[model samples]
Target chain A: MLSRPDFHALIKENRVHSSLYYDERVFQEELENIWYKTWVYVGHVSEVPKKNDYVTKAIGPTPILMVHDRHGNISLLQNKCPHRGNQLCAYQKGNRTSFTCPYHAWTFANSGELVGLAFPDGYEGVDKSEFSLGKVPRIAIYRGLVFGSFAKEGPSLEEHLGDAKRALDQMLDNSPEGELELTAGFLQHRTKANWKFVLENETDGYHPGSVHGSIFQVASSPVPALYKPESLALTRDYGNGHTEFDLRPQWRHVGKPMYWFNTTAEKLPLYTEAMKKAYGEQRSQEIMIDGSPHIMIFPNLFIAEIQMFVIQPVSVNETIQHVTALQFKGAPDFNRRLRQQTMGSVGPAGFLLADDTEMYERNHRGALINNPEWIVLTRGEKRETRDEDGHRIGHSTDEVTQRGIWRHYLKLMTEQA
Target chain B: MIDENEIDPSIAEPVALSPEQELMLRRIEQFLYYEARLQDLHAYDAWESLWTDDAIYWIPANGENPDPETQMSYVYDNRSRIGVRIKQLKTGKRHTQTPRSQLARIISNIEFIAQNGDEFEVRANAFIYEDSLRGETTWAARNEYRLRLVDNKLKLVRKKVVLVNNNKPIYTLSFLV
Candidate 1:
């Protein structure tokens, strides 16, 4: 285990120690201090919209089963049989009024109540109420999004979200109904990189030109060059480690045809007509012109325009990302275009994300080398300006978001437990 | 904006092939072998020329779904996008291709499912082995091809790849798999 002084020495104002990327001790500490104590996104209400619907998820190293019970309430329960610590829910997802433990025929109700146990006379004094599934310490829902935390006392979900709520609303409000639901399935993938690398790559605007250079070059259509100085985009560091790159402000008023090549003018008639009908002309036009930005709600959840990323840390060096593409229920044409655009960019065999696999793997390999003690993150520091909410704002092609991540990371890591 | 009807509906009803049709099937099998070889050798130009102007290359996700519009796919490239992908593979700074993946694959179980005019619907099973600096991975899939004879040459109209483990998480599928 690293001592307090050793951890302090690893992180500095302009650089972070390379060991943070590959150290097993650091990984464990991160799960305990960060993931366990913070509100982690589990799933959306739309995932389990009806009674008995459930989805199995993980928070750091612990598996959690989120289910909608018969009384129309959602509960996050530890996926373990209280009798012998055996796993109860063996499936990823299904509709079940009661889950029977395959080990000993111990059954639990969908609402997490202990309903039955085989050969009950053998365990006479055990109280069924005390032996029910263990619920997470704290659970809350903001809009349709669900989150759970292990810490008994801390900031509420809204308090933790803070100014980042605006970004979440922007995505949901794009739907004329002011709501959205996840599609049928998700793209679950594992990569050879730390979870933080995934978060940093998602919010970092400086690397797109180099990392995905081939994608823009061969796209054969008008795609925004994120690295260009004239792009006029900016990174906003909403306090509490939540950050985003704001592209909407840059493209909303431009009036140029900025739609992705796949979502062409010819395909927009039906969807545009539907949007106009639902939200009227002005709001529909505004939604159409604005470009969606990537928003990271520190540690676990990442919300892009049409897709959502759920980060699960497997170890110090490996992470699993769950990619869910959101679909508007009412608009079939728009949903079709949205699915195509998302798949082309971030799907498993996508034009953009496939290019990132090599870079992430190489980064982890380099981190294992002991020679370089620090990785610099000092880009665009001097020109950064503070907003009214005290968030640091820098140009689109700057490392401002990375700095913001480290700033909050240091605070959480160094605080006395 | 493609009509769903244009898609080759899966033909479960197998028909007996005449001697001429069998010869055509043999030639189509040869064409598939050559196409796979070109991709393995990184012969981008030769591979690009095998497709017609309106060709479609698709890889469905979460199992095979008939509709590409409603369900997401791993790859949904039209003719122009296919050209762009070829150009991307040849670029000097493609990090994924810096130490490119070495691939070898086997195509088997060839069956002529259906035919319409000059276009023939064929089905086959494939297993691709990819080796790179990161690691080695084997991908198995069902391949459905829509081949048309244009000017005495077999030009690809559409190719749909259905992976066996489409519902599970996968690593980088950057190559032509």
Candidate 2:
């Protein structure tokens, strides 16, 4: 029997034990207590735009598929064939009228209705409803992103999203049509690091200067400026393990819009015109200045400004990231720029991201070393404070987000125990 | 950003050519070898100089079916972006390339696929073996290049790298493919 360590002690106010990155038992418990029990993001609704469109993904080790059925409903279906344990749909993404298991030829409608099976004479007494594909107990959609939970009950998606909903709101409002198209394919990156490294790195605003100074030096980036102490950009702890690098203050400092893109409205005249036409001139300007989010939703999803990331955990020391360009519908010109920028700044070969990945691998290696056994995270805790909405806000280059994430994580790991 | 309707020089079928055309191919073959050498040596400046002003260096994601305008690509650098890539490499601060990965590449099967006046299309095979602190990573790709003769010297206008495992998860593409 594995002994349990107090997660509260492991996760302190200003530091976290390095063992969290290497403990297999802890990783398994995380999958059971959090990933399986709580709502896990599966895929975006934009990914399954039409009926019969389906994409396969995994929640922890269990394979699941997201499908848009004939009834214009989006739902989650277990990818396992009820007859035996063969994988039902193997392809990454495709249009499928029905899922037919290759081993036993068990055919099911796209809506998880088991239509028939090969050699049915032997199974004439079996009930089709009982043999149909299993589904996640709960499926929720919030602002086009799909989430599935295996547990029968917990917080609703709206309640789980909580303050984090603002991030998605800002992201969607960037588009004049107030809709997004994630048709741009995924760029998957394999990492030899713990899944927690990805979550920690998402809002660790301090590392950009040290880790990504090279790329920023060459390009006229607004990121370096935001890290300055005097800069108005704030790092926020949105509670529930969600965190953000809120650059809105610096973006709005000029009292004008389009600073996030570092371009004038004149440059993207067509997009600007559409924005004004859709949401009126004043609202359009505010939306442009507010820009998109650089936020990490608890456990897996990240709305990293120009791109979106879905972090998938494999083991204690292995993880994979699915990255895609954030596309705005009815804004071809802006989408074109965003697509080109995403190619340069993300993925495995990305100028900024490659260096960060280096840190991820190195961080894992460092954690393995027998040391003080703790990773010091005492960056800006002294200056951190809460806002009117109860969000813990700190300097852009602060560790308040880290502390907040650990706080929420401690609550989940202990309460559910 | 490729046009599906038009005949792409890089992917065209190879045909038997005249002896005179073979001589022209020999010169282009030499340029390919020279280009490969610079990449292996991490010669950023010299390698960058091989491009024309209106050049494109692209690496298509998902095996080249969908165009870059529709589906995302690994790299879709147009002239200036290519310059930024090289500039970042030279900055001595790219942690991914700080202790740059030692690379050795082999280019083979030079196919003279198409010709259009001063422009020529060539297809070749490349296997790049990289030895880094992390471990060894081998990258294999089909190199499709569109070369233009500027002042009687071959200059790269476009180079498309189509990796075999584009559809699958890739470990590290921090270095040149």
Candidate 3:
């Protein structure tokens, strides 16, 4: 085990030790301190909308089942059966009143109650209450998105989210009904890179033009204003490792019709008309101009360009990225456009994302070099400003957001185990 | 969602090919063989030019799904997106392509699934062997091509690649499958 001082030495304000990415000891420390303790996005309530609907997902190393109970409450249960530690839920998703373990025929209710056991007479003195599938320590939901924390106590999900709530609201408020769904299935990509690489790259503004230059050059549509830093988009560190690439305040006053940002009145006639009717013209205009803020919800969640990316660390150098393109429940045309836009940039073969995967692997390889002790995180330190919400806002071309992430990471990683 | 009306009526079902159609099959097999060669050689421009102006190159995620608008896909590109992708590959700045993929593929089981006026739906299976800095990836796929003969030259209107492991978590699909 690394001492607290050793953990503290691994991170600094302008640079972090490369061992943070390559060291198995550091990786194990993260799994225990960060992954198990923090609030991690497990699944959305929309996934299991009705009674008995369930899906098996992983929050770090623990496999869990997110199921809607008979009372319509969503519960997170360890997918492992209490009997003999067998995996209980084998399928990815299904509707079932009870799950029967294939190995021991131990039956668990949708609510995670141990209702049946093979040869109960042989284990007459066993307490059924003690053998129920273990429940996750806590679960929190915001705007239909569910998050699970393995720690018995910590800050509430709301506190952890901080000013990142605005981005979630934007995602939900884009729909007239103020709801979004994951009707569109996920695009899963397993890459040979550290989980932190995905977290940093998602909010990194310095790489778009260089890393995704080919995509930018080839897009027939007008480039997204966020990609053009001259437009003055801000990368804000909301603390708690949550940060957002804010497009709203920058483009709020751009007073011209821009098609990519959806400000043009004639660009999407049917969808625009629907939005206007549902949200009124003024609010519709705001939603359009604000565009969608690229958000990193610390540790695991990422909402960028209309897709939700959940980073799952498989090993020291392996990460599985699950991306779900969201849909507006009431707006089919708008949802279709969102899906198209998201598909263009994310997923396994996305023109923009495929390049990023390559970069992550290469970056991981480079971090393995023992000579380079530190990876630079300094970019726009001098230009930092505090927004009204007390979040640190930096230039779009800066690495301020990464610094924010490491601050919380260093704090969490160094805490007494 | 793909407009069902926009889809060629012939691909709606399988049909028998006539003698002349059978001859066209021989040419298609040759076309597919060289198309694979162009990709293996990293001749992106030549490979891209093989497509018609209104082409749809798709690799659906989570099994075969007809609706690209609502369903996720590995690669769902229109002609413009395809152009941008090829442009990126050509820039030689895409770091992932550095020491570009050493790829070779075997195309087999070519058959005419259906035919309509001036259009044909062809299906084939392939085993693509790829090697890069990361490691080797063996990709086996069911390749479905929507072709049109323009001025006696075959033009690709669509290429739908269905990988055997379509629903699983995949590594970087930087190269064409």
RMSD of each: 4.3, 2.7, 4.0
DockQ, Cα level, model 3: 0.44
Question: Model 3 Cα displacement at B124 (Å)?
Answer: 2.1
Residue B118 deviation, candidate 1, in Å?
Answer: 4.1
- For each candidate, the DockQ is 0.38, 0.49, 0.44
Q: What TM-score number comes out for model 3?
A: 0.92
Best by TM-score: 2
Candidate 3: residue A139 lDDT (0-100): 96
lDDT for predicted candidate 2 compared with the true structure: 0.86
TM-score of each: 0.90, 0.96, 0.92
Question: Which one is best on lDDT?
Answer: 2
Candidate 1 docking class:
acceptable
Q: Write the per-residue lDDT of candidate 1 for residues A27-129, one digit (tens) a residue.
A: 8778878988889998888888879888888887688988998778989989999888898876677777888888899998988889898999998898888
Please give, for residues A58-121, the per-residue lDDT of candidate 3 as tens digits.
8886778899986678999998888799887767777778889999898988888889988889
**Which is better, 1 or 3, measured by TM-score?**
3
Candidate 3's C-alpha runs over 4 A off are: A1-5, A220-229, A256-263, B1-22
